[model samples]
Target: MYAFEYKRPASLAEAAQLLSGDDEAKLVAGGQTFIPTLKQRLAQPSTVIDLGAIGELAGIREEAGGVTIGAMTRHGQVASNDVVRRVIPSLAGMAEVIGDPQVRNLGTLGGSIANNDPAADYPGALLALQATIRTNKREIAADDFLTGMFDTALEADEIIKEVHFKKPDVGHYEKFRNPASRYAIVGAYVTRYGGTVRVAITGAGACAHRWSAAESALGGNFAADAVAGLTVDAGDLNSDIHASADYRAHLVKVMTQRAVKACA
Candidate 1:
């Protein structure tokens, strides 16, 4: 990694101040992606502000008729937290399979969502569950927070505080992951809130997005057969060596069907 000054702030205010003062500074939550990029010489920030020392940024709480997860909360904590498992077990399950132990233990929810990796698991969950992302500046809807691949709506000085997720009546996630990286090639998160059904898809496009057609069909009949005739457009999807756009589109339907069935 290129030489850079590192700061581990003890409080959120301090971190925000440091970030705002230095335009070339970068924030590190778990350093899962940023650290690797630094080592590869892809990013050379003058300062690396670490959020790990901010105790208030990490925790799991049950509130607001759902669950509020602190931004710096680690994947393994989310996966194993009793409150998370009880309130949104499917979300916990998604976290459980995000990556191998090392990644799971090191990656943070805030970093994952803020980075907005198309193949990341949390984006799909946030979109499907209708989450509210609370930052140091303002509250942004999950749909508005994730813009595109490796992008978010966060400002240069903004810091995510917590994510509040609406507890769905029923929810499940399924994915066809790349074996080596364990990143989703095509993943689907299905959720039903009373009569409204939401289907969020990931790893198939530039960003995680909802599958409206499937939601409409599933809202009418929450079953696998309801989506049997449904198909996702492959033109806009990612076509990497791991899977073609068409294949990922196909997996979208298959995974959605499987997730819905799992919810049942």
Candidate 2:
């Protein structure tokens, strides 16, 4: 909203250089989140570096036992990609349900993961699938990459190149979203490989987190009924006009059940 210089660099190196040199500069991926923040005067960057012109940041590749998605890859592309559907259908399903058509077409994986929104779908999926976050500088495990609400381990000016998700033997994501915005009130992703099980819960706390209790319970039984007795604490959850923390906590259990069932 405020007057700011804009630069659409042809390569990642130029974009990084532009960002690193300016103390008050920001990177623009899809601008789904950043644009609104700027309009509200919540952020005022001296310069805006757009990564849209960089062609290398936009594709999907199938790996030996996983799928590697580029940073600028849109949700719509991921949702409809044959390789994604064949290798990790749950991730494809997650992308298909994100914020309707416009948002799907504009929102990028790197933007979503870098913003680290607690209610974002990709964070929970990354955690459950044990994905790797690849940056220009280094590759960070999903567990270590996300630190807190809207926070990541990425250094200043660091650009995420891609994200790699390992194929789970069985996986599914279930979300209870706010009707108006479609943001997850409480979302759960369940993944299983051999005897190991992993569960990630989002929108119920400060950040998307792995639900170890549910993982252990379902790892032993691999059934919806196995998690019926589990209770999520509301003590550290989000509470607002749409839903109370108590309600969100309740939904976490319900959605987790649904996700597990989908996997089964």
Q: Show where candidate 2 strays beyond 4 Å.
A: none
After the best TM-score superposition of candidate 2, give how far the Cα of residue 60 lies from its true spot, in angstroms: 0.2
Tens digit per residue, CA lDDT, model 2, 58-143: 99999869999999999999999999999999999999988999989999999999998989989998999889998888999999
Can you give the lDDT of residue 241 in candidate 2? 91
Candidate 2: Cα lDDT at 132: 95
Candidate 1: count the clashes. 0
The digit string of per-residue lDDT tens for model 1 on 44-63 reads 99999999999989999999
What lDDT would each prediction earn against the true structure? 0.94, 0.92
TM-scores of all models?
0.99, 0.98
- Give the lowest summed-lDDT range of ten residues in model 1: 142-151
| Residue-level lDDT for 242 in candidate 2 | 86
Q: Name the regions of candidate 1 deviating beyond 4 angstroms.
A: none
| Alpha-carbon RMSD to native, per candidate | 0.7, 0.8
